[model samples]
Target: MAERSDFSFLDEAEATCRLAMDPAATGIDLCLILERDALLPAVESIDAAGFFIEDVAVLDVAEGYQARYHFRRFDTKGRIELRVTAPHDDPHIPSIANIFQGAEWHERESMDFYGVTFDGNPNPARLLLPEDATIKPLEKDEKSRKSYLDLMPEFTIVECAEGHPIEELAAKRQAEREEAERKAAEEAKKAEEEAKKAAEEEAAKQSEEAGEAG
Candidate 1:
């Protein structure tokens, strides 16, 4: 039988949510719910505790997107889940790419399919979607979406120790998202221009060939 993990330290650290371990039901040792800003720090804590990143997964819920990070310890027989939700309008989370190099592709795949932005990821380009795909294939319909705030309104949102408003962080993230959009637009424009140039050149070559035949 797998031993139950001692996750009391997370409670002391003031985690947003501390669900007891149920390896049988959840197939994991612990579940720690973290506020957006606290995610990076909590992940660093877990890394320091000798856990390795297993996979980054996301779910499209009514409230928004839930980002679930699975971690496991190779030396020990233990695993844990770190989960956080991002609002649909501004679905952004700090990327763990720096901590786990393999997370780059995982984050990209999530971004391509769910439109969730993993902030701080060195490369945020589409991983699986066609260059022209604007819609996230995995996004849920409006009628089915659930409100994450409604689901857990009682939980306190963690803020910076300096008392920075969550709104400020949200705004900063929104700005980053806007910047990424602008860059994508520019790249798209460049591609269009190149395509037009190529088409014109091909047409001219065809015309020259016809003239030679005449």
Candidate 2:
């Protein structure tokens, strides 16, 4: 796990998670899940550490809307995701556009999709969605998100291992294949036995006919 020397200023906030660094794949090293109030302080520390805001995205989960602030440094390799959850009733958080100009567009897009109000976002214009659309399509569980199979091919998160969520659908598929092979082998053995019985009966009848003729 790559340590963030700058995070010490945040007073050991409990929501931090250390993920193994994978620069080649995703380039993410750390994930800090923070409350709305801790958002500014955490980002301040990140900025001091020389990280720049990459993008801001929003996701609607069972708990509420999740605002994800993606950050990375040009001089450094790994990326960090700073996440904050807002209640379903009132999803809002302070905007970081003032700190990083790139966050301005991202915040607007997130607000457009998930109805997360960025408190100080300057424009807050609808980037992609229709202006008249009142419903946040992303917030509706069925509308915007795809199933696990669609996203990961065939994996479902059933448990966790070594601090990562483990998908067990592959194991379930292997069991199904084993069961099918077992049934096929049993049927083949049964057919072989029936053929042997028929051959033996034929031999016995032929011998009885020969003896009667003699």
> Which has the greatest TM-score?
1
Cα RMSD of all models vs. native, in order, equals: 21.8, 8.6
C-alpha local distance difference test of each model = 0.76, 0.69
Worst 10 residues of 2 by lDDT: 151-160
lDDT (10s digit) by residue, model 1, range 25-122: 56776666677898888887777777788899988887578998998876666677788889888999899999888789999999999999999999
Q: Tell me which residue pairs clash in candidate 1.
A: 62-145, 62-146, 63-146, 63-147, 63-148
lDDT over C-alpha atoms for residue 78 of model 2: 66
What's the lDDT for residue 141 in model 2?
A: 64
lDDT of 2: 0.69
What TM-score quantifies how close candidate 2 is to the native fold? 0.59
The candidate 1 region of ten consecutive residues with least summed lDDT is: 152-161
After superposition, the stretches of candidate 1 with alpha carbons farther than 4 Å from their true spots are 1-14, 146-214
Q: 72-139 in candidate 2: lDDT tens per residue? A: 76664567777787887888899988888889989888888888899988888888888887877666
Could you tell me how far off, in angstroms, the CA of residue 24 lies in candidate 1 after the best superposition?
1.4
